[model samples]
Target: MSIARNVPFETTLQVRDTCLCLHTQRAARALARRFDEALRPVGLTSGQFSLLNALNRPEPPSIGAVAQLLAMDRTTLTAALKPLEREGLVAVAADPGDRRSRLLRLTGRGQEVLASAVPIWRDLHAAIEAGLPASGPDNLRGALAALSQPALR
Candidate 1:
């Protein structure tokens, strides 16, 4: 014998269909799966590709800076970097300007991997955008950007 909650099944249906967080999470996971499949040939998950891409700048960026851009916490970012570092794809060093701070950069091999991944990313991105409904990719990106803004909190 099980006790039933006060909430009705209709409430669950409503949330399943209309909740922004649920929809966003579902969509994000789907996109990640597609990218991960596409990037597998290069031995990267979508998250790893994104991390390596972020470090492809002219100058090395601080860990805090990259963490902010990636919308991840410092500890999480550090954990994510471990595999890349072990593979000799990313180098993390103390920032000369601030010894306590760490800076991140892609190694030569990382750049080569990212370079190969770019065309794959471009093709899939184009296909995804082209297949979107009337709201379009730009509008979707704008909405996501707006929601991601710190001011929203």
Candidate 2:
């Protein structure tokens, strides 16, 4: 197969508009894909990693709180948590203050799993950072923040 070089990225159909946004999304997709492949041995997708990290925070954060933190809808977050719960990696408890809500927390085994995944995560994060230097993350966050403002409004 012949390989073409200098191909422009596009997020939408129109060449001009898509060019502005497509590159970042393409980057995210590619990065996530690479992380997923690397994380396969640890049995954690990037989503699962975020979920476990959220749960591993202070015990018994409300489901709503976790969803908000992840910026995921409650239903989506609830559905995702099911697998972790079934796998004995997470435990959802009834909120003591509010019966209508549930609280999510990681189990001991979950902690162990997260600990196991850390090295792999560190390696991936390091590799990415190394490409853009130490401030790479800060720059990314800034760009994302700037991009999100209009959407939020």
Candidate 3:
């Protein structure tokens, strides 16, 4: 039952205005919504599109490798794969080298769906780029990549 200190509104305002995490999270949410709407016709959310795209590789990638690439934990990646697997869009196979490890590959239907989504993605991406100022997209990408570096964590 000690004293309760009240935080000044100025501090809250400062954080809202200056926090990089807050800004990035807000931007991500907005971008996700935009992509979701744009991709609705293709029957995919932005996350699904990304996950499927990640599986599109010549050689199947291991679960751990994909998790690292997507910046998601193995558990989250596994959970995310379930729907795609159920839809027969992706297949998970036990790695020959390591039975304990699983590799992810896009099924034939997955390739077809991803191919369909590509033009939609390209159009939206170009629109986004056009809306940005000169070099804005590149600068933003560089900044995001820098922020995502493991060292920052």
Candidate 4:
């Protein structure tokens, strides 16, 4: 009665072996785990670190801008900011230029946390690159960047 019963085992194996999305997702999850572990002492997850890092700009970015930079939807970005805001690590205020839009900035506490995170990130990043294949990290980064472009999708 299961729909999976209709599909051949070979098809499943093929997808497992050849699917770029599946491989990328697995790799992304593994990388996130590593970064999460590394950042635990600083009390940030990989996603939170990224969100906080994005907000560490001279000019507070609009919610729309930050969402685009983070490859997230406005709603998801807003949701993610809640905990950081409550912790006094981030501030969200209505944009003066546009009443409906919100601007995001890293608070002084957020800067301190981010400063603590940078060296950890750099060390881990260097270690990861050093362990990568001879094709090297640059090639891997280039490929990921190309894949990130919406037009390619």
* Number of clashes recorded per candidate: 0, 0, 0, 0
Clashing pairs in model 3? none
- Per-residue CA lDDT of model 4 for 58-140, tens digit only, reads 89999999999988999999899999999999999999988888899999999999999999999998999889997879898
Instruction: Output the TM-score of candidate 4.
Output: 0.94
lDDT of 3 by residue, 1-153 (tens): 989999999999999999999999999999999999988997888999999999888899999989998899999999999999999899999999999999999999999988999899999999998999998999999999998879843
Candidates in order, TM-scores: namely 0.94, 0.81, 0.96, 0.94
Give the C-alpha lDDT of model 2.
0.84
Residue pairs whose backbone atoms clash in candidate 1: none
The deviation in Å at residue 116 for candidate 1 is: 0.7
Candidate 1 error regions (>4 Å)? 1-5, 151-153
Which one is best on lDDT?
Answer: 1
For 26-85, candidate 2 gives per-residue lDDT tens digits of 877898898888788978988898889887775679988888888788999999998999
Residue 117's lDDT in candidate 1: 96
Model 1 lDDT tens row, 102-146:
999999999999999999999999899989987888899999999
Question: 1 or 4, which is superior by lDDT?
Answer: 1
- Model 2 spans with C-alpha error above 4 angstroms: 1-21, 133-135, 149-152
Local distance difference test, each candidate: 0.95, 0.84, 0.93, 0.93
